[model samples]
Target: MKTILVTGSTGQLGNELLQLSHLEKDYRFEFVDRSQLNLASEESVRDFFTNKTSSDYLSIINAAAYTAVDLAEKDKHSAELVNVDGPRNLAQYAKSIGAKLIHVSTDFVFDGNHSRPYNETDLKNPISVYGKTKSDGEDSVLEVNPDSIILRTSWVYSQFGKNFFNTIARLSKEKESLRVVADQIGSPTWAGDLARVCFSAAISDQSGIFHFSNEGVASWYDFAYEIVRAFGYHCEVIPIATEEYPTDAKRPAYSVLNKQKFRKTFEVQNVHWKERLYRLVEEVKGQKLT
Candidate 1:
């Protein structure tokens, strides 16, 4: 059986992909973290694939990333090592071995100045160190391996890791009210949904940049409100301006991506953010998910 090597197996999307591993029975999934194949070191990547033939992986889903947006500004070198050099190394190896590389990127690649949704072909003008590294990573992947598939998603969250959802969900239980930035707007993406799309891209012949997110858009405050309501948490979610919650890095005011390309290309549809969140809460309640 061909293998699907998934990096960053501990991440939210990585774990989500692992949960769906049983769905693709024909392919053996090799889920590796930093210990197995550290993307930052080219030597580590080469050593990991040493003695292995070109037919080993059907696709290498690069889910590993240095995702701390604000901290990226303070530590540019670390971010570049993981976000820039990492994908480049992976793409080089994938190209040499004739393997497809499916890379997960971010909507942060755009400056978020547009009132309309961003298409796949939009010129990226990332405003933060994190965004720039991710953008550079995408370029490296495409340059090294033209056959790579790049999926630029926005505001991703899940049960496995720390994200907006987890933060708000926890705060809702502890505090009586929560304040979130209402100015910054973007669609929230569920890792499970994105994982399903990654698997589809892996098996399909598609190769290019595509945007993926939930059906509808929401501000941070809107997302928080829905989260609190989902689990029957009585916390009041208040809308606050971006100025009130200042961060080290600047954020895009509107970064919602156009998913027409992704949906039409994959021939798949996604649920709205609210409905998806509702379903997830209902489904995970029985599993003892916090």
Candidate 2:
């Protein structure tokens, strides 16, 4: 069986990918946490491939990244280590061994200046530390391994992590009103859908940048309202401007990605954000009832 190495096995995306192991019977998934393979340290990454697994990796899915957007401003070094250096190391290693590498990136690569949806051909103009690091990461990966696939997504949320969905659900119980930024707009991507795309890209011959997100655009306030309504939370969702919520990092005002490239290349179904939110809320509620 072909062996697939998945980094960040415990993260939102990686965990979602783990659920698909049973379906792809032809490929054996080898999961690893940070302890087994630290991307920041070249020695660790080098040692992992040298001694850890005997079989050559058929595909490598990199889901690990320093994702705290606000925290990234204060922690540039850490962010660069994982975001830029990590992918660079992986790309170099993947190239040496001829392994198919799929690296997960964010829409932050673009400065959110575009009035239209961002596609793979869009020029990257990162406005924040996190965004800059991610942009650098993408360049490094492609510089070493042109065959490597870069999957740029935006506003990702899942049941596993501390995301917008969980935060709204929790705060709604405590606060009667929830204020979310109304100015910034982007598509909310379900990590499960992203995980499926990662697997698809890994198995395909197509390589280059691809944007994947749930089909539809929404602001943070719009997303919060939908979450509260879906979760049956009684809190009133309040729309506030970006100035009201000051952060350490500057967020893009718009980051909706055009999925025509991904759809054209992979030919996968892209679900709407509202529909995904409903299903996820229902899934969580059902799990709670049991």
Candidate 3:
């Protein structure tokens, strides 16, 4: 069986990939968290790859990233290390070993100035530290290894991690009312669905940048409202403007990505955001019963 190295094994996407690994019996996956493989330290990353047998792994799925948007402003160094240097190191190593590199990125790379959905060829103008670092990471990866596949996604949530879905679910049960931003719009991508796509991309020889997210667009308020409803919570979800909910990081008002290229290239149909969220709610509720 071919080997696939998955970094960030403890994250939402990493856990999803682990859950789906069983379905692909042809590949042997080695999942590792920060403790096992630190991306911040170039020496650490080099040491990990150096000790491994050459050509033992067929691909490296870099799912690890410093995704704290607000905190990234104050913690720029750490973010740059993980977001930029880490991918560069992985790409270089992958190039040396003749292995494919599948680097996961965020939709924040583009400033939400466009009125319509963003395509892969759109120019990137990041507004926040996190976005800038991630954008730099993509550039670094491509420069280091042109064959690397950079998958950009947004509003990622999953049942297994601390994300928007779980946050709304917990708040709905604890409080009777909630307020969410209605202006910031993007697609809510379930981590499980994203993981499956990543796996498919890894096995294929497709390179360059690609965008993937659940079909349909929604604001944060819509997302929270759906979560509350799906979980059978009676919380009053009040929609608020972005000005009402100020944060350290300035997020794009709209960052919806066009998935036409991804769909065409992969020949796969993306599940609607509502349907995926309902499925996740059912799964979470079922887990509670067990």
lDDT of 3: 0.92
For 105-134, candidate 1 gives per-residue lDDT tens digits of 999999999999999999999999999999
Q: lDDT of all the models against the reference? A: 0.91, 0.90, 0.92
- Residue-level lDDT tens digits of model 2 in 227-285: 88898879999999999999999999999998888787897788899999999888888
Models ranked on lDDT: 3, 1, 2
TM-score of each: 0.97, 0.96, 0.97
| Full ranking by TM-score | 1, 3, 2
Question: Distance (Å) between predicted and true CA of 152, model 2?
Answer: 0.2
- Candidate 1 segments exceeding 4 Å error: 286-290
Which runs of model 3 end up more than 4 angstroms from their true locations? 51-54, 286-290
Least well predicted 10-residue stretch by lDDT in candidate 2: 281-290
Which of candidates 2 and 3 reaches a greater lDDT? 3
lDDT for 119 in candidate 1 is 95
Mind giving the per-residue lDDT tens digits that candidate 3 earns over 1-290? 88989999999999999998988888899999998888878788888888565459888899999999999999999899999998998898888888899999998998999989999999999999999999999999999999999999999999776788888888888898999999999999999999988998888889999999999999999999999999898899999999999999999999999999998899656899999999888878846311
